[model samples]
Target: MGATPATRPTSTPRGLARVGDRVSFLYLERCVVSREDNAITATDDSGVRYIPSATIGVLLLGPGTRVTHQAMSVLGESGAGVVWVGEHGVRYYAGGRALTRSAGLVEAQATAWANRRHRLEVAREMYRLRFPDADPAGMTRRELLGGEGDRVKAAYRAEAARTGVRWVRRTYDPGDFAAGDTPNQAVTAAAQCLYGIAHSVVVALGCSPALGFVHSGHERSFVMDVADLYKVAFGIPAAFDAAAEGPEDIAGRTRRALRERIRAAGLLDRAVADIQHLLAPYRRADEEAAGGKAEDGTDGGVRLQTDRDGTVAGGRNYGAEGVW
Candidate 1:
């Protein structure tokens, strides 16, 4: 379903937004003030708070997600790549919940990438198991992409198809970079930011990020579930951009540098914004179906008119949408 810590995120401060901090997760309906546990428990506007403020440090205010602490905790514990709730009722999905968190960023991203290599190896071995003549010393990311960098786009879509999930697809166009374009410094920088953003969402949504679509282990199945969606789409492009450009301009030359630079790059906020928007409708649906309320404190479920199948009439498609 996703990537593990080994999946190579584009961010530093491994597990950014880790546990033990206080949090303020603001949703369209209510604001949550609490501590960040494996799950970030929230205080509902109904004046019902299940978490203590001392454990909360992060104030996630914006058009993101709102979920029960119980749900958030699930994502956090599993090393989820991204986790979020709908406005109130639709869903509280946690991607990449089945991977390992043994290493920090450089190590983690390296591990994820290494694991990718190992996965290709294992695939080769599996093929050998059947064919008995498959090459064992062969396999490369280039081949994974059908020997063309452009094939990365297809690799992304094909992987997402496995989970019946669809995420937005993007290309790093010239429009993506204007004057002072960081192409010379983008790969590493972007990777780190992506990791941080991915893990943050994973924890919030209750998914473990250690497991993966291409790499699955028992340690972090849920985390893998989500991370896979971003690894190639977000992680690879970032890595390729910087790696493909001048490789000598940056100062620090370690993967940590890669992580830090990526972290420094902007757009985690935009990613968060996009994640929130994607989550809003689902959260609302889940909440309303269970009689959740809105910021106005009005019951939404009571008004929802559904067909016999329990699916809302004239409602936007939620489950059917796959990786974009």
Candidate 2:
């Protein structure tokens, strides 16, 4: 008989305390993922092994992983990002929802990103964080983009010199991974790893990855925006170091190195903090201006209170509270 949905636990799992603790996991092998007790377990040919769902940032379900609904519920509640990817983590197929229940953060994100002046300010802040020595306040959007491109090129050269890796043009064909040279492959792999990590944080923070300030239109625009901030610090150097190794399994090696670098840099936590920092100004302004007291007995915060007539209380509509 197949395993039925297990009873949801009342007490929180110990692993839940480890939320936002680790970076991500890539499940390359075929396995059956389920929930046992309060934890998640993966049963394969070897045996049943427990997976700490709460601590993991991204769960990359590559080929051959069958996840049960119960396991997914546990993961979702634990605030983990569940993603389906192709072999070697090349292509992204689908992603699950975030564990955060609050829509406040995402609403703030949309409000800031939708406003022209506010979006520009956020973009400038993002650029300023990456290049602290430079003042982006005086620069226009076009100028900022040009400056960032130039800085990235300089960073590539610096990494190449530091690692003694040959500096060549970045060439890659996503559909045909083998078409790229060793360094190019390494760079691509490192970048893919970073994207997965960044996406996990973006989802966990209850923000829309599709909505972005500096990067626009793409489904993972916000992911790209956040990942770019750490590319110079982590991805570039990792690719260079990996390229300096034996030609065999360069991508795998690069991924492993990138994982280590992510941990050392505390990237999972940093990504969450960065998103909050980038969107904080808007949230602060909204709170100060409109998120006043609610009839629900909350103060200096946004709360929804309704009367028996099914209308908002406190003599304030949703608009007055800036919640809409």
Candidate 3:
């Protein structure tokens, strides 16, 4: 006879911690991940270490990491994001679940994105957040793009001067990471890390990564927009600091430094607040216009679309209304 199987508990949204309250991300590699009741175990040459599944916001599976199906299922149930990345944050492969049950925020995003005026307003808000000293009001998209470019270039020069690293213009060859200097390598590594973090938050909030205001024509356009908001505060400084140490392991050092900076700054919490703020008006309009349908997406049920912004129950046959 076959042996009996162990029972696994299912996790619900209310049972898991909020995204802002959990760890930003945990990076693992060269280990086998498997489920152990409510926690996941990472086994390697060292030993087995158990991590609470519900406490993690994002899990970065680096090179050589092998995760079992049961482990992935548990992570999905806990609403934790999983991202497959390169050893030193050089590449990104794919992403896992959206970790949301309701479609309120995404609906709001789409509604605002569909209108040209609303889209431009959101873009201006993003720039306003980035450049608090300057006013982006009544600025055209072309002006916003120019100002952003100048600000970023100024940031690069400032970091280079502070760290005494040879500063050339930003250059990145995705096919060859080593072609760039130490600062460039570090910057790229830090940028990838920030992107991963931003993506996790975006998906968790039930927003579409492809629908972006400041950036467009990319699958991760919204992810890039969110990540750029923190580049000056976290990514650029961390990269320069790592490069100043030496080029021995610039990428690894950058990741570590960036992680520390993110944690110290409580960036996850701030990011959550900023995203909510950016979409608050749309969310309110959705709620008022759609009768409180724009909630935080913990309904755990699906709905069908009806005429005039109404929803009907899902998984039912409505064939009784005859008229072929």
Candidate 4:
């Protein structure tokens, strides 16, 4: 689901693909892409298009597209966007119609591979058992994450724990629960890492990022889902010691540093393994959501499972407007 680098659809896509780059996108119908010439063109197909990034206008995720109205309004308002990629190869526009207001979604089941007795599942299961009251869908993101501190501290107490005093700093970093991004690089970095891992997991499972157990929409979908179990693995100790916030000016800089840290952790790899195990469950969810198979075989081919990406792939069978 990633961009051209991690096999994402775009080329040179820190934000969007650059012109003269070879791109492979599936959700073209979700929006109108403005090319290099400032000419805007609406997309419609599950088909992959190699448009010069410069020639792209807005990447249109049109009416029949599964994007959200909030997203529609947002993207319609702004001319720029970022393509997001998860560990399992999820690649889609970060600010598209499906997740304009909500940002992005990675819908997948928590128990997609619950039956597996592997070490990863075992570890995840142990984490789940810690909070029996927690919902698989993430009914209480703020509440659950708020309580993660204690569980994180408990991990420090574990005899098997290889970490030491530094773990304490991570657990109690004041920077973790702040507003500004720059002032809290450590905490922000930890959160970004956790979210990146969670996003990757959702894509691999082929679930919708926007759907969650406790969460609904607009606040990042699968982020809440996997973050519940996945984020705690790293941040419990690291973010705990982070400063509450930094200067407002350096906020964006701090976020960049945070992204670097998250990327260095290689959490995406772990999520990929975990997500692949859940594929069977996600497929079932997809089927149920679609109310059986696609009338003309729309979903299940494109790996990202994003609203607009699905719309693009659907173009081959359905019309450019994503009609079946």
Q: State each model's C-alpha RMSD to the native.
A: 19.9, 5.1, 3.8, 14.3
User: Which segments of model 1 are wrong by more than 4 Å?
Assistant: 1-150, 153-192, 208-215, 218-221, 231-233, 249-324
lDDT of 2 at 8: 49
List ranges where model 2 is wrong by over 4 Å.
Answer: 1-6, 9-15, 24-27, 30-32, 43-45, 63-66, 87-89, 284-302, 305-324
Window of ten residues with lowest summed lDDT in model 1:
98-107
| Selected candidate, larger lDDT, 3 vs 4 | 3
- Best candidate (score: TM-score): 3
**Candidate 4 local lDDT, 1-324, one digit each (tens):** 322222323211223322112111222334434322222334456532334332222232322444434333333222222343222222334442211111111222444323333323333443454465554243243444456666655654541244322323333233333332322334444454455445433442335566444445544655555665544445534443233333442323333444444446654455544444433344344444553334554333332245543432333444457433
Whole-model Cα lDDT per candidate?
0.37, 0.74, 0.81, 0.38
What tens-digit string does per-residue lDDT give for candidate 1 at 237-304? 44443443344532123233334433454334433343333233324334434433333443222233
- The lDDT ranking, best first, is 3, 2, 4, 1
Q: Candidate 2's C-alpha lDDT? A: 0.74
Q: In lDDT terms, how accurate is model 1? A: 0.37
Q: lDDT score, residue 282, model 2?
A: 65
Candidate 2 on 1-324: residue-level lDDT in tens? 544445444323332544356646554458888887556888889999887666677776756889888888777777666766554427774354555444556877998998999899889999988888989997899999999999999988998898888878888776877778788888887887778778877876678998888999999999889988888889989998999885688877888888888878787777778888888776634343444334453433334444431223344445555532
1 against 2, candidate with superior lDDT: 2
Span of ten consecutive residues with least summed lDDT in model 3? 1-10
Q: What does candidate 2 score in Cα RMSD to the true structure?
A: 5.1
TM per candidate: 0.28, 0.81, 0.87, 0.37
lDDT of 4 at 50: 37
Query: How many clashes in each structure?
Result: 100, 0, 0, 74
